[model samples]
Target: MCGIVGYVGKRDALPIVVEALRRMEYRGYDSAGVAIVDDSGHLMVDKRAGRLENLDAALAAHPAGSFAGTTGMGHTRWATHGRPTDRNAHPHVSADGKAAVVHNGIIENFAPLRAEVEAAGIEFSSDTDTETAVHLLALEYDGGEHAGDFIGSAYAVLRRLEGAFTLVFTHADHPGTIVAARRSTPLVVGVGDGEMFVGSDVAAFIEHTRDAVELGQDQVVVITADDYTITDFDGVSQQGKPFHIDWDLAAAEKGGHDFFMLKEIAEQPQALADTLLGHFENGRVVLDEQRLSDGDLREIDKVFVVACGTAYHAGMLAKYAIEHWTRVPVEVELASEFRYRDPVLDRSTLVVAISQSGETADTLEAVRHAKEQKALVLAICNTNGAQIPREADAVLYTHAGPEIGVASTKCFLAQIAATYLVGLALAQARGTKYPDEVAREYADLERMPDAVAEVLKTGPAVRDLAQSLADVNTVLFVGRHVGYPVALEGALKLKELAYIHAEGFAAGELKHGPIALLEDDLTVIVIMPSPSGRAVLHSKMVSNIREIQARGARTIVIAESGDDAVRPLADHLIEIPQCSTLLQPLVSTVPLQIFAAALAQSRGYDVDKPRNLAKSVTVE
Candidate 1:
């Protein structure tokens, strides 16, 4: 994944685009660059390896150029095709300096295209697939019927390309215009008075304009200072669906926090509340967008959930709830491995896809495959107008606002809340639960925001415990029933932020194999179920705690508010608010997040931007 921004506006393009890139830096930060069409019809370009600050320093040192040009584009890369280097940075320009291009996503046929261009006796500059696009554009503009036609040349180049990409082009001859197109990647056009903008997401130009036009697949857009036009690749006129961003610019900024991760963690309460708001009307649960009718939901025989990373963990939780409520068989599959398995499907099957960005490469492809097999597809997503939701038969928006943290916190919780609503809706549609039972479930959900807030009160204690164990070589987490996914999520957070060796196992499976890894003073965190409900699970967990403690392992137990049975057994106890058996994840997951952040910060790591990771996975 990479961040891209383009501007054809009255304001200075360089600063505007650079600031937008800063907002989207969580997307990618391997390298940064910009290309601009100056006022005198000249192309000015600069790039630097490493973070955006490196490019900023280069711009500061060479401040005499035409960075003030009103037509420009910028890119912060994630480095898929080549190493992170100055020459490999984006905004790859033509040799004659007449055309420039920036791109996101992969070009699968780039090798053949590069060979063909090189066969024409044109030398190449860098080891990036994006450079081939610029060279082809320059060649198309140099001669032939498309000669001197900038948009026409861009169209010609786009028609020859295969694979997913979002390309924005600028030509020195076309001073005030920008041509942009998308095949499968994300590209949005922001409509502003006397100006226009294009970026990977609304966060790029949200400060200047909230009105945005979301382009469909295989569409092209031409933007000038005062107007914009949309068309298909074959030159047929088309219109992009427009929507206003509900959150403002301030939501994208970290307000007096050490990092965006910390801010997002603190915002979890509001995130969950907002996701649950307006979901219940007229004593029934509803979805954000429901193209599938009630009869369609009732006819479902099997359910499949496809997702990756934290979203996959949310899907695992959804499996438990959906099956329990609707009595339907649910299967959770990793999106990367879904289609390859050649799963059984039909019109009666319902496929649920979960993704925070909704552009996750594997999950989007899985959704496409499910739709091709004539299965009804429903999507759970955070970002509005994202590709997966746009292609699905129905969608449920998480309403978590902008999650800028690379390691998700608020969005993960919001996904759980939204999935719970989906479960209730399915149960209602299938007549599996009475209307009064569904209302009670919704009421219990409404009280979870406060329960989550209560869990935040224990952050100080969790941080203290985490700091003491920051030097440990390995940590193990164990849970049972619904807590199994929470344990897995905890281990994932630790591995993502702290870069430590961590593993999660079912509490009952300690003796199976994971128990051998336990040694003297090794830390083991156990998520204890509620003693009031499922006494069997709580007792079994206590036995697992004892098994680990007998091996001289240190214990940090997360239990309900008053669990006296574990008082004498736990070396360190962290309490969370009591909730229903299935709803425990909503509260149990908070302390683990706090503990992971504090532990990573204690080790002097940047929790916001972990090494070798980007916020979104746009490439497979």
Candidate 2:
């Protein structure tokens, strides 16, 4: 996961590139750099192998007016081909320093290509695969006279390389032009007046303009100061499709909050309500204008939900609900591993692909594979009109607007809510539940926004508990039933935010193997099931808490209000509004989010942009 930004415009490229890198800090990086074509046609490059602040410090040490250019490219790199060092950082330059390139995605055949370049007497400077690309371009240049000749040579060089990548290059000879190309990786062009921008994603230029262009497969774009041209590998000119981004620059900002996570945590009430709105109309759940008949749903034999990381956890929770409501066998698979194992599928099988950003590469590929196998693919996506949604047979959009933080909070809740709605719709269509029964479940779904609001009110206490545990080296989460996935999400948040060694295990599995890790210094966060319909689950989890507390483990209990049985064992008790067992994940995940955010903040870490992590996984 790397971030790339390029600008060819009238404004000074330094400040714009630097600010865009800051916005992309959440995408995780070990180094930052920028290369600019100055007004006098000199290629000026500055790079450092640390956080953005380290780059800023280096820029401050140089003279104020040292570098100037109207066009440039910048990159924040997550090391793949080399270590995190200045020489290995992005914006790799040619031996003659005439061409500068910033690249994302891995190059599978860089070794053989490097051998060929060395055989031709070309010298290399860095260990990055990107350096091979620049040197290859330099060899192809051959001191070309026409711009088209140089462009054609660059395209020829790219044709020899293998593996996924998005490349943006600037030549000193063409002072104001930037050449960009992508294959299997994301690249977007931002349109502006008398200016053009290229980046790995749309967030890079949201402050400048909302207008953007999506680059399709094997397309190349040459952007100049006043215009841009798109072409294919065979030198045929092509056209670009324009897309309008709805979120403004303000949504990417923290709005004076301590961190992006905290601001996002506070935005949950509105986010949940926004996701729930318009789903219930005329006593039925409607999904993105696609209506399914009872026969269509009843004919389904099996269901599979595929996702990665937090989205996978959401699918785990969905499996419980969908199986209960529809009386169908459901399996949840990690999207990255789904296609490799040759999964069993048929016409009657339904595949649900869950992703907050529908651009996740592996999940998108899995969706495509499922469709090829003749399975009906339904996408539970928060992003509208993304690749996954376009490929799926149907889509249920989660209206949790723009989650900028790397660690997911509101989107997880929204995914659960959306998956629950899908389950209810399936049950209603199959006549498994009466209209009144579906109406009753819809009432529960409607109350979720307020229930989520009530759970958020417990953040203060959770924050206090987090501060007390900030010094603890290890934390463990244990739960049963639906609380099991909640525990996994809790541990994931802790690891993502606090950078601590944490593990989540089912409470029943603790004694089987994980109990040995629990000791005096270890803090255990247990999600206690509500003492309502799932009395067995509630009693079992309370007993598990007691078992761990007897072992000298500090217990942090997240339980429903008025649950007196669990109070005695709780070292820190965080209350949640009572809801059905299937919907408990919506409320149970709140305290975990607050705990992780506050703990990370207390340790002087950036909770929103956590170390070595990006907001989306666009590369496989």
Encode model 2's per-residue lDDT on 1-620: one tens digit a residue: 68999998999998999888887777778999999898788998889999888888888887777768898889999888889999899889988888899998878799999998899888787888889998888878865333345577678777887877889888888788898998767788999998899988787888898899887777899898788888876668987778899888788778788877778877787787887788888988777745445566778889999999999999999999988988989999999999999999988898999999887888988998998999988898987656688678888898888887889998998999888888888888787888898889888988888888888888888888889777989999998999999999999999998999989999999889898887885799999998986889888887898789888988889988999998888988898998888888989998899999999989999887787787777778
Residue-level lDDT of model 1, residues 68-141, one tens digit each, is: 68998999999998999999999999888889999999999999999988998888889999999999998999
Compute each candidate's TM-score over C-alphas: 0.99, 0.93
Residue 70 error for model 2, in Å? 1.2
What residue pairs clash in candidate 2, if any at all?
Answer: 27-614
Task: Let me know the TM-score candidate 1 reaches against the reference structure.
Answer: 0.99
Model 2: residues with Cα > 4 Å off, grouped in runs: 61-64, 143-148, 235-239, 289-299
Candidate 1 clash figure, as a count: 0
RMSD of each: 1.1, 2.5
Worst 10 residues of 1 by lDDT: 59-68
